[model samples]
Target: MNLKETQKKFHKTLSEIYPKSEIDTFFYWIVEDVLQLKRIDVSLNPDFEINEKDLKTIKSQMNRLQQNEPIQYILGHTEFYGMHFQVNPNVLIPRPETEDLVNWIVSDLKHQPKKHLLDIGTGSGRIAIALKKELPKCEISAFDISETALQMASENAKQNEVKINFVQQDILKLDSLPEDVDIMVSNPPYVRVLEKEQMCDNVLKFEPHQALFVKNNDALVFYRKIIELAITSSKCKTVYFEINQYLKEDLKKLIQPYDINKIEFRKDFRGNERMLKLLID
Candidate 1:
């Protein structure tokens, strides 16, 4: 069938599962990835025909999307911080809010001298790699419990042409970082188990749970450990976290006993308290 016919069939088949706008997005993304045609090309060349092999691949991806799989996983890559990143089930897809977190770090440290930075639970290496790209003079290291995630992060680092020291170590078990750093940043698993219902099926079904969830009673477990480690590590001058909005007060209480120079909370585009920065003296 032609591209227009394929588009209609794709929308009709998945209409119940996704909205028209989302379906349109998925269609264009698939078209560009599979057919090597831009969205404007599709509109300009309405009669464009996709070959049989390409048609089969498109249908297979549609089947997966019908099952609520994320388009990022289907495409095997996603745009984050204006760069392309490879993603899979082993690593969480990078989100726009995390971009805000990265910008926050860049704004704070851009004028400072070269320093070391550590990204805890750096799945897909988005935060670490982006910072390395932004602050080319700084040394960056990232660690994760999952070997597969670290592997993908390493690949992404290489793809982005940014060097990052990727290590496989669980933050929960680390009493201190392996290396001293001026900035310690993490967008750890802050989603509580009870909040699963609020997430869409695409995320719950396809994304790695290890990178997205925390127990209800210990929602801030990763934060707690990372903070303790940062506070104890003399060289870690600052700590950054992409946090759950509901637990802002809890996070403040968690850091209450620590010696900190300043604490700032910033909201995402949604106006939710999604980023936190703590300056440790």
Candidate 2:
């Protein structure tokens, strides 16, 4: 089929499941991934032909898309912090809100002395790798509970040409971190299990559960553990977390007892208080 015809069919199928605008973007991304053509090229050459084999593969992906499968999972990559990251079901797809957290950390480091940074619960090593790329002089280490996730993170570190010490250790254990870490950052599993009912079926069904859900009653388990660990084990200059939007006030109160220098609640692009930057002297 011609590129235009294929995209038309794909959009119609996807629009039945998702909004038309989103489906159009999805169609563009799929065509780009399969054909290695830019969006402008697709537009300029709408009559570009698709081989039967290639057409079959694209059709299979369309079927998955219609089933509400995420486009990132289909394409096996995502763009974050101006870099492409390999993604899969083993790790949570990096979100734009997390990019704000990365930018905040990088901006704060501009005036501070270069020191070691540790990324706890570093799934796919997105934050750690991004920080290391931007601040090449800083020492970086990242830890994840899932071996598969750590492998992906390690690969990403290599892909980004940033050296990160990727360790497969649970942050809850808090046993593997080094002393005198100047900064500790984490985007942990803060989504309470009970909140799964509210999540889209695509997310709940496809994404890794271990990377997304914490116990309902112990929703702040990761934050509490990481905070305690930072207090006792880190001589860190700062601690940052991409927090759950609903718990901003509660998180602020939770960290009040500590010797925090500044607890800045920053909003994401959508203006939701999605990240907390804590400076500890």
Candidate 3:
């Protein structure tokens, strides 16, 4: 069928699940990814006919979308920090707010001498690889407890053409931070179980839960461990985290015991407290 007709049916099938604008985005994203046609092409060629095989593929993806699967996972890739990274159920999809956290680190370290950076719980390796791309002289190492996540992260690093040391280790069990790491960054699981009602099904149902949630009573578990490790690291000078907006005060109290010289919180585009910077003394 024609692109316009297919999109109309797509919208109809998903109207009960997603809003009109989101359906439009999902349709166009699939078109661009599967059909190799740009949005403008679809607009100018409204009658553009999709082949039967491709149509079946598009319909299959629409079914998954109807089931509340994230489009990124359906497409097997996503764009972050101006680069594309492969994604799957193994890692959480990188969010735009996390880009702000990456920007904060890049802005501060861009002119500094070469430093080693470690990304704890580096899911898809978005933060570490982006930093290495922007600051080529810097060495980067990323570790996650899930071997599948580490494999995906390693592939993403290769796809981005950046060299990053990918390791498999649970952050909660690590004894010490890497000796040469000068800066550490993470967007670890900070969502409390109680907050699940506030999230969308596409996230809660499709994204890896272990990479997005913590126990309700211990929302700061990862932060607590990382901060304790960072403060004791001889070469680590600074740390950055993409945090949950609701836990800013809790995070503040959690960091109070660390030998920190400065602590700053930056809001994301939505004006929520989402990023944190800690300069270790």
Candidate 4:
């Protein structure tokens, strides 16, 4: 199949499940990965021929996407905060909102002295790895409960040429992090179980549920535990979290014990409160 033929097939087949805009994104992502070509190449050489083996692989991936698999998983990796990460069914694909959380932390610490960093429930090590890339002098450690997820995260760290200590420990059970950790970040499982209906079939079917969900009645469970640990640990000067968009007021009340002036809720570009920054005395 030629480039034009492959493009036509992708549009025709994927349009059944994804919108035209999303289909364009999926096509470009697959083209760059499979063909070692840029988006410009699709138009520059519409007649370029795809080898038989590569065509078969592309068609196989199209079949998977047709079956509701995420294109990131089909590609076996994804980009986050300008860095690529190896992903699988064991970890949740890093989202743009989480990138924002990472940016907030990096912006605040980019010029500061070296500090110890800890990321809880660091699926795919996206946050931890990105932080290490941006803050090369900082010591970074990331933990996840799943060995499969931790393995994928370690691979990503190596591929990115960043050093991150990946640990297989459940955040729900771990009461404290290492001392001297001046900054702590977590994008824990904050999506409530009841909110599953609001998600797309591809995410619900393909993403790792353990990394995406928390109990409906206890939506802030992870936040609560992590904050308590930060407070008790006494070494965490600042805490950053990718929070549930719907729990703004609940989070404000939950952290009441901390100085209100130091607790700030930041909204995502969508205008919902999606992150929190807490400074401890």
Q: Candidate 3 lDDT, tens digit per residue, 236-265? A: 878899899889989989888778999999
Question: lDDT of model 4 at residue 74?
Answer: 96
Candidate 2 residue pairs that clash: none
Error of 3 at 38 (Å): 0.6
Give the per-residue lDDT digits (tens) of candidate 2, residues 117-207: 9998888889999999888889999889899999999899889899999888877776534875878899988898878889998898899
Off by over 4 Å in 3: none
Model 3 reaches what TM-score against the true structure?
Answer: 0.98
Deviation from native of the Cα of residue 172 in model 2, angstroms: 1.2
lDDT of 4 by residue, 1-281 (tens): 89998989999998879899998888888889988989998889999999999999889998999999999889998889888888888999888888789889989999999999999998889999999999999999998999998888999999999999888898878867788788889998888898999999889999989889888888889888888878787678788998888888899889987643498888887787898998877
Position 223, candidate 2: lDDT = 85
lDDT, each prediction: 0.92, 0.86, 0.92, 0.88
User: What tens-digit string does per-residue lDDT give for candidate 1 at 1-281?
Assistant: 99889999998999999999999999999999999999999999888988899999999999999999999999999999999999999999999999999999899889999989999999999999999999999999998999999999999999999999998898898877755677889999989999999989999999999999999999989988888888788688788999999999999998888888899999998899999999888
Global local distance difference test of model 1: 0.92
User: Clashing residue pairs, candidate 4?
Assistant: none
Write down the TM-score of every candidate: 0.98, 0.96, 0.98, 0.95
